[model samples]
Target: MLEIKNKLYNSKERKMQKLFNKYMGIKKFFRLKSEKIFPLNENEKILYTDKYDYKEKNEKNKSDKYLSFNKRIHILSVIPKNKIENFYYSFCNFVKKNPSKNEFSKIILDERLKKSILNYSNSLNLGGWSNLGYTTPKSKELENIVDYFHLFIFNLSEDYIGLDFTAILNKDFNHKLNEFMISEIKNEPNYCKYYVGNKRFISKTGLNKDIIRREKLDDILLEIKMRCYDFLNLYFDLFPLNNKAPITFDEYITNYEFNSKNDYLLRCYDFYIFEDKQISRDMDIIINHNDKEFSQTFLDLYLC
Candidate 1:
């Protein structure tokens, strides 16, 4: 009987010790180092590199001409105002005629209704805040008037994947769209060039920030550009512009390249080394030259 009691007490003590050790281990794992207590300036920041002198020289001579160091690359395609207007008209007509039980119907109808209300408000001079004394009236005919909404093709891994026809409704539409698209592309089965090192080794030890060789970096950038081209092609294929011949990849995307000595890229590399996972890259798009005018018109007509 005494032996059994001793065994039970020993087991309980072992369990308590295991729990306490686990808690401390976790706490230690998450604790910030003394050096990280304060923010470091660009020059003072510590990077895991053997060639510190070479890196410093490179940083001093770094050019600001290339695209940002963020893994995502922005590809811009411009559509003529007339083409966009035509597309909007066709889209509205299709939605009206088809009347399907999909979400597209609601989106299109709602936007149309809003546009009508905006036009009505403009005619009454109720929402005119612009310096222009008179507000221009929008045509009642959908085909004659241009819509303010921009179309966004969103692709998010494990989250959302679809089109956002009313992207302009949200003020942070650009950021949200880019974030979702990047997340979606990262989930692609072939998107693994960014994760090329021994993740386990890097995690057990510390990551060498200069692990990415110039040749490897070049390959990664090329792959990223190709991926961007493919993404743009897919979007255009699904929704052709003005019912015209499919635009060539070059026609759709003007530029896709990475800049040198980007801190964001370095941080992303560190994250992958430690987490054994890839973070979504960022991207920016060049809006059409007339986008500003169109945006102003949209604000004047709808938002006031």
Candidate 2:
């Protein structure tokens, strides 16, 4: 965890040397094994994460349930060892404004947030107005990842084939992924925006007005996304995919109700990120960010 928070992308040698500094002394060996999930920083492109203050206490990542490594970071393969220390700092800082949640429940920068932070004028039009993702994944992977750009991840070891994740590192994402996945795993249909839930297109199932629990809903979305990609051969009708239609991230979470044909939707993908205000009335959804990492809380019902 400390390695991730302060990992240097100077080079693989520097990364390994730094990692070795805390090499578990027998006592921590097994516990440390889990941390060795991905490839060694061959070229160490570690995104600098220290600049921005995290929600946890004194920069203690463990204090933040979402930041916990064992829970999040599901599909990390070998993200290039980047020399972009400022990248991490820049990412974390941007997350301070437009934050996101990892599978472990930690707050991190949205993958697409990088563009906005880099301030490439008119960049919002870049990357399809989605969040952030640096290491785009191979088509075969996205099976278990939450979002390729951020760290939210998942693992269905019991009832699945291979690991799945959002790949933000794949150099050629759209084209290559299309080739590999063909009909198996592909982007949202031409007219769909994913709303998190069963076929009803609502955020909850078999319940009425019980949408306060955003975190649990997030977990449910993971299950749905996995099934949507692996099990369903692109369930287009069930999601909101049209380019003209703006996908509602948590339609049910709002005071406004939804109808199946309204074309309004809810989804976990368009996470609500805020700046200045930290504590939000997440209601039942998980809340992240600190005073500086966060400030006040406000809910703005989005209509694209």
Candidate 3:
């Protein structure tokens, strides 16, 4: 555990290093390999641990509870290292903001959140948003929604960079992300007036109900952004392709199969290069033995 911490600390991923340094207990949890089921304090019950004599216990009794639990823990252990890191940071950040047991339990049990985080972790393990060359329509749509929402928050409030657009959309507008777009834009004036609007959206007069609501919203947005960025920063660290070397020509040919060369694939292929001299030599040998004309055309199109 200490070795892993030291390695991560020296690596370029500072966010992950800081997370590990701040929450060393998590490292202990992951590293535990005991084979005994121990009791917790008298007041605590249902404390799950991976250390249980599953084989002996299952043979002694007909029950497979210990065996099942141990299997689940083993499965968790096999989760990609990056995903576990991301899950830890996300869990910690969520706990810091909402400490109540009920709140924490609700989030853990949320199926959508779990699935989304897992999918995101898988993407990070691969290459993240930029490396996703040609995605399905649904994925493309979600990315567009999130990206445009960020842009909308900036444009709506004259480049205000403090609000948590993701949280607001997740909590209040999960099913209707575009809800506020048309309504908010309706109040905007001609081009020049937009540059001189007040920082606060609502008025502060009379009972000042709108002002209080705006202030409260701002505070919630700020809190949400804090958690979101904390998760994002940690996830960015776990994203393996964040600062990876460009894909070599041989690697590109061996790994990926392009059915049709669309503009997006063309753009991505252009980014792939032969940095390693050996890989470049191997690619030339393969190209010579294969369809030379096709290879020449592909190189002409994408090779830098």
lDDT for model 1, please: 0.29
For candidate 2, the lDDT comes to: 0.29
Q: Is candidate 1 or candidate 3 better by TM-score?
A: 1
User: TM-scores for all candidates?
Assistant: 0.21, 0.17, 0.17
Per-candidate clash tally: 0, 52, 0
Candidate 3 lDDT for residue 99? 35
Q: Which tens-of-lDDT digit does each residue in 1-304 have in candidate 1?
A: 0011122233675567646545544543444243377544433232221223233221321344222232222233333322333434544554444333334333444665435423322243233221101111122221112122233322222222233232111224323323332231211011011234654211112222233332233333333333333433433323343422222111111122222334543333222121122223322122222344532100001000
- Candidate 1's clash total is 0
Which runs in model 2 stand beyond 4 Å of their true positions? 1-133, 141-147, 151-206, 209-220, 224-294, 297-304
Candidate 2 lDDT over 1-304, as tens digits, reads 0011111123476555435434422323444355458532321212111122222211211222221011222222111122123434643553453333333534545555444434432222223222243332223334333234343212223221111233222234322322331123211101111355654221111111112233333443333333323321221112232322121122122222222222222232223443333433322122334656543332322222
TM-score of 2: 0.17
lDDT of 3 by residue, 1-304 (tens): 0012222123566565445444533433543433135435321211223233122111121232111000000000112433444554554454344333232222332565445444443342332221111111112212322221110001112211111212212223322322221112211111111223654221111112222332333233233223333333442332232332111121112223333334233332232233222233212221222354544212211011
> Model 1: how large is the Cα RMSD against the reference?
21.1
Error of 2 at 139 (Å): 3.6
